[model samples]
Target: MSLAAPSETAPTTDSKVVVITGTSSGMGLAAAVAAAQAGWRTVATLRDPSRADALREAAVDAGVELDIRRLDVTDEAAATALVDAVIADYGHLDAVINNAGAGHLGTLENETVADVREVMEVNFFGVLHLSKAALPHLRASSGRLITVSSVGGVIGQPFNEAYCAAKFAVEGYMESLAPVAAALGVTVSVVEPGAVATEFVNNINLDRDAEVAAAGAYAPTLRAYLERTAAQFLNGAQTPAEAARTVLEALTADTPAFRLQTSDWARDFTAIKLTDVDGSAVLGLTGTWIG
Candidate 1:
C-alpha cells in the first residue's frame, strides 16, 4: 500500500475524496483504482491491509496514488473513526462506497440461526454502520453514498436464503433513504450486479460433492441448484471491473439513479419483480433452478 508524502498528504484541488471498502479483490479493487484514475482522493479500505497487494498493484499500473486504510465495516466504532480520520486528513469528507460484504450458501434448515445472523452482520449491518457514519459528512458535501447490492436483493434464489435476506434489507434501506437523503443534499443509491463472475462467486464456499452429500433430504434440489449455478458462472459471469464501472457511475453521476443495475441482463432479471403483481412470477422463475 502506498502512503502519501507530507507534500501530498492533503487533497489537491483536482482530487475528490472517496472511500471504498472490500478492495482486496473483485469490484472493490477495481472501483478504487477507477476512482483514483478518475481523479478522486481514493481511500482504499479493507479488513486487513495485508491483502492490499492487488489493490496497490492496480493503483500503480493505473499511475494513481491511493490512501490505503484499514476498515472493518462490521465495526460501528471503526466505521465512525475511519470517516472521522478521512475528514481530518482531507479537511472535508466526500463520498463513501459501501462495498464490503460476504456471501453465504446455506438454506435455512441446513444452517443454524447463528449462520443467518452472521450473514446479516456483514452484508446488512456492515453497510448500515458505514452508511450511518458517513451520512453527516456526505450531507455537508452534497456527495454520493453508493452501495454494491446484488440482483439477489430483488429476486430470491435457491440456497441463498441468508444472502438474499441481507441484500433485500440493504436495498430496502437505501430505497427508502434516497428521498430523505436527497432532502438533505446527499445522494443515496444502490448498484445491483447479477452473476458478476468471480466478484462474488469466488467468495462463496461450494464444494459440490461435499455439500450435496451433507444436504440430506435437500440433496437432489441442492445438486440441481449447484449445477445450474456453476454453469452460469463458468458460462456467462461478468468481470469484476465490469461491475465496478456501475459503482463508479453511481459515485460520479450528477443525478444518480436510486436503483442501478450493472448490466441489461441484471435490469431484465430484476424487472421480473418490478412488474410482478403477485409473488408467483419470482417464485415460478427461481423454482426452475432447483426443480
Candidate 2:
C-alpha cells in the first residue's frame, strides 16, 4: 500500500468519501466494510498495510474495495496530508471515524511513565490529531466525526487508569468539539461501548514481567487487580459485529445521538444515573441522615 494523492474528481451519487482508521481488525475493519457496503468510497487506514491483508480480503469479499494505506495516527503531518488528499480525490469527506486505538491492561502504579505516555499517544493524541486534520473537509461536506471510545470514557473501572484516562480525555475532547462541529453542520459522536469482544482486549499489551520490574514496590497489587479484570473481560463480552452496527447507525441515521453505549450493562449504568443521591442516605441509620 503505497501512499498516493487522491484523484481529482468529485464524488457521484453512487459513492461516498469516507476515511476510517485502525481498520486492520476489530471494530474499525467492521465499520469500514459496513460503510463501503452502504455505497461509500472507503479509505481504510492502518498502521501497516501488510498487517491488514485479512481485512482487505474481507472487504473485497463483500464487493467493496478498501483502499488500504499506511497510517500511524500519531503522525500529525501525515494525517493532515492524507485529509487533504482525500478531499482532492473525492471532492469531499462524508465522515471521519477515529477508530484506531490500542488498549493497555495494568494498574497506574505498575505502568511506567513511558508506558502511560505510549498509551496516551495512541488512544488520546492519535484521535486528537486525526480529528484536527479532518475538520476542514468534514466541515466542507457537513460530515460526521465519529469516535470509537469505550465505556471507560464515562465510568472509572478498577486497574485501568491509563486506558481510562485516555478514554476520559477523548470524551471531554469530543464533548467540546461536538458543539462547535454542530454549528458547522457537522455532527460529532462518541460511541462509548461496553465490553465488546473485539480483538482490542484479546490483544491488549500485557508485558507483565517488564511492567512489574519497572515498578518493584507497586507491582503485586496492580498485577493481581489486572488479572481479575482480565478474567472478567474474557467471561462476558459483546461481538464486534453488533458494535459495528451501532457505529453504522450513528453514521447514517437522520438523528444520531452524541453517545451510544452497546451493552446491557451499559444500559443499566445509564439508567442508574437518574437515581437521587438522597436515596443512599435513606439506607443509613436515622442518626446518620442529614435532615
Q: Using Cα atoms with residue i matched to residue i, what is each candidate's TM-score against the true structure?
A: 0.95, 0.84
lDDT of 1 by residue, 1-291 (tens): 234322124445356789898988988988988888787898889997677777777877878888888888888999999888888777777898999999889888899999999999999999999899888888888989999999999998999999999999999999999999999999999999988766466677667899899999999999999999888878877898998899989988888899999999899999999999889999999999998
Q: Which stretches of candidate 2 lie over 4 Å from their true place?
A: 1-14, 207-224, 270-291
- Candidate 1 at residue 27, lDDT? 88
lDDT of 2 by residue, 1-291 (tens): 344323112334357678889988888888888987887788889897567776867776787666667889998898888887776666778898999998876665555889898999999999989899888878878889999898778665555679989998999999988898899999999987777777787578567667656657666655665566556568877777778888888889998999987777766654443353554432332212111
The TM-score obtained by model 1 is: 0.95
TM-score of 2: 0.84
Candidate 2 Cα lDDT to native: 0.77
Please give the distance, in angstroms, between residue 59's alpha carbon in candidate 2 and its true position after superposition.
1.0
Clash count of each predicted structure: 0, 0
Residue pairs with backbone overlap in model 2: none
What is the RMSD of candidate 1?
Answer: 2.2
| Candidate with maximal lDDT | 1
